[model samples]
Target: MPFDDFAHNPRTLLHIAGALRNRGVSPLELFRRVGVPPSALLDANGWVPRQLCFALSEEAGIVSGDRFLISKIGASFELVDFGPWGRTIAGARSVGEACAVAANNVELLHQGSALRFFTFARHAELRFEYHGRLGASPHQHLLGSMVFLRKIALLAKVPEAVSVRLSIPYSHGAECLEETCGPRLEFGCDYDSIVIDRSILDASIGDVGPNPIEVAETAEATGALLKRLLPYGRANLETVAAHLRVSARTVQRRLRDWGFSFEEILDDVRRTEATRHVISGENSAIEIAFLLGYSDPAHFTRAFRRWTGMPPRDYARAFRSNYS
Candidate 1:
């Protein structure tokens, strides 16, 4: 995958840096070890490298000499730390509603993983599964998530009397697990999950004072605008901003903070659609060019060459001849 696809919100890294600083560990040194620049932490809307985020969390455990460093950080994490998504979660009426919001919109915070929520006879489970292996980082990811889930449950004001257990796929030394997360750790489990009392699911967290319908509408609109150029569309920053009732410059700066550019996203869309059109053999180069919004066939050819290292005709020929 392209590095851009691996991007995630920078707040994750910023929070980790704050945690490391509190422990007297230099986050700069950790970033250096992981090959990420120190300046990346400053961008409020910036996306930190996905690999580096995991590496930093893993390194924090090693450098701080705390086996549960990730859990500590996650436990301390506040809903507001998640920005708008956190507010959406905070406004949810019940634990299940909150988990649903987090599970559905997790990619808005980090594109690396998927979250699932389930309810059984006596337990409500929140599960985390990454899209791919992160080498030694799953330990951190799983442990951090264990604490993060517990924190969210607590935020729902679930009673202390409720029983909660954590099931993890890895065995992280039983003593350390118990010492850090209490006696409810179940190792060698089928997944990383948080199990809480099912009764807590309906426990009201109170009205959070925002209209859920309005919040959902706003989130959907922003998501649609950001993804407008994908698959097939011609949308630039100015056009998108106009649609969103915002200034083009404001859109540009916000996109910058999110680790994307109007041009780059448009290019990605074109590159993807162009490749598909070529491979499918459904459109001539000129037709594809016109469909892709190019005025000149020659200009489209040049762009296609830049995208694929070959002319469109050659690429199509190679693709069809192989399958035929």
Candidate 2:
């Protein structure tokens, strides 16, 4: 569980399932290979561990015999796949503007990775990078993203100006990439990027409009995300921000606008939930501590004292005696 805290939108897995179905592979196979329960995607906006997704991509390659399977998935990329994030991207006035939005908000759509849009001279690049711990096998994401990125350029009538750049070498599935992505797909490169002509950056995509979502709705959404992530994502400010897919400062500012602080909200949530568990008498103090995001039972004891003016054991014993 070294990297278990990293998570992504479950929509990605559903997208993979649809693509696998197209290739005559059973979607259930994804769960078997990754050993995660099918219920993981039950919530419409819940988060899934990012490593499970990466492992599924790798396994999907084996079961389907197409390492380029992810590229095939990206080939059909639609704005809807990104949910509200897609709607925001669709509102950008130009290709470059969209790229800028994508760079700033990649975490809203995907966590545990980075995306950047930059220009040098006559060419511009949208670069995607995974922290080195992921190793090279996960390059399918780079391939799939490049294919999808090319579509953005195509919207501007400049598909020819777009090419793929991946640090991975040409191998098993490179031929399939060459056929679909054209010869511009280069392997063993220095970066994973979507290269475009600088001037094409000015190509119009849509009319500029105000963002469709409001700050208050975002604050409520943050609280909802916190409720879901508290059990697995941890209750710390940084972890909550990561799950909200926004910066910690942004999370703090939003919570403040709602007249609440992150610590206040987290403490209240923990108290309500932990109080219920202690009263129910179903789980031990240590188990409740772990569920409350405490690494040590002592931490939970201190917190329980702060919440109820007694340690967890005393509170639980008192509750049981009243019922008995």
Candidate 3:
């Protein structure tokens, strides 16, 4: 198989960077070995040459010196890291629904693989098939992804997962991989795929699955809602949820999925607004505190201390002294 005609997401390399760090491998050294720039490691917004992504991943695997690096990548992969594609799948009510959602959004990843959902008389399969395999890196990359999909199935209590497919020939070392891939695994297959019992398709994701609000876009929306509610001093969970037209409990759950607490969002809003008003010199500390919904100036002082390591006035003075 050829390597450079297509494009691939750079996030795989970003994940590899984390894996390398975990194994005491310097990302800088890996980047040098792979001949990719450090800045490009984080350039996940667009696609790069297919060859480069695989090279980085393969090099990272070598540098980490960890045989279980693919499993490590899967273990650390979070819903948020997948961005909108991940959130949409996680938001599905059922396994089939999630698979359907994933099926629809496969192109967004451009990860040198295609996903197709199939229904048989006995079961349904969410297949991750590579377009072509140039080397070991492609299978390694796809295996990490399959493990994540399998994790979702396990989380949803799917009792039967058929196995994982690998493009390489079978070997003794591959047996140890079952711990990460679960009990079933196949080797030397044309593609990598996951199979689960058809009965589990209709099963609900319940509280165990990731929430859609975990996506950064949704997190920003939550932040926007908090900004508007802060002046009311009731920027607490219930009030913000009311503004969002979602139940308070849902708001809490979704924010937790977004990796933040309501209090953290509220504090961030207060700190940001406080800094702005203070820097603008448009209001007294008391007025700024009131505007930030603090009942007392002392509370704002304490918060500013926690945020900037200095009281508001002292920081304001320092800000001016430095800028003036």
Q: Give the top-scoring candidate (lDDT).
A: 2
lDDT of 3 by residue, 108-127 (tens): 77655678888898877778
Tens digits of per-residue lDDT for model 2 on 55-119? 77777777888878887877756655566666767878888888887788877767677888998
Task: Go through the candidates in order and give each one's C-alpha lDDT.
Answer: 0.65, 0.70, 0.68
Query: For candidate 3, what is the lDDT?
Result: 0.68
Write one digit per residue (lDDT tens) for candidate 1, span 1-324.
653456567555535655676677766567657765544433435576667677777888899887788877776566765667778788788877887788888877777677888888887777877776554465675677677766666655654523335454545464565544556666666777767777777777764443433222322344455444432434456666788787877666554433334565456556666888889888888888777777788988999898778998899888888888
Q: What is the lDDT of residue 177 in candidate 2?
A: 87
Which one wins on TM-score? 2
Give the lDDT of residue 39 in candidate 2: 42
By summed lDDT, which 10 consecutive residues of candidate 2 come out lowest?
Answer: 207-216
TM-score of every model versus the real structure:
0.58, 0.61, 0.60
Q: lDDT score of model 1? A: 0.65
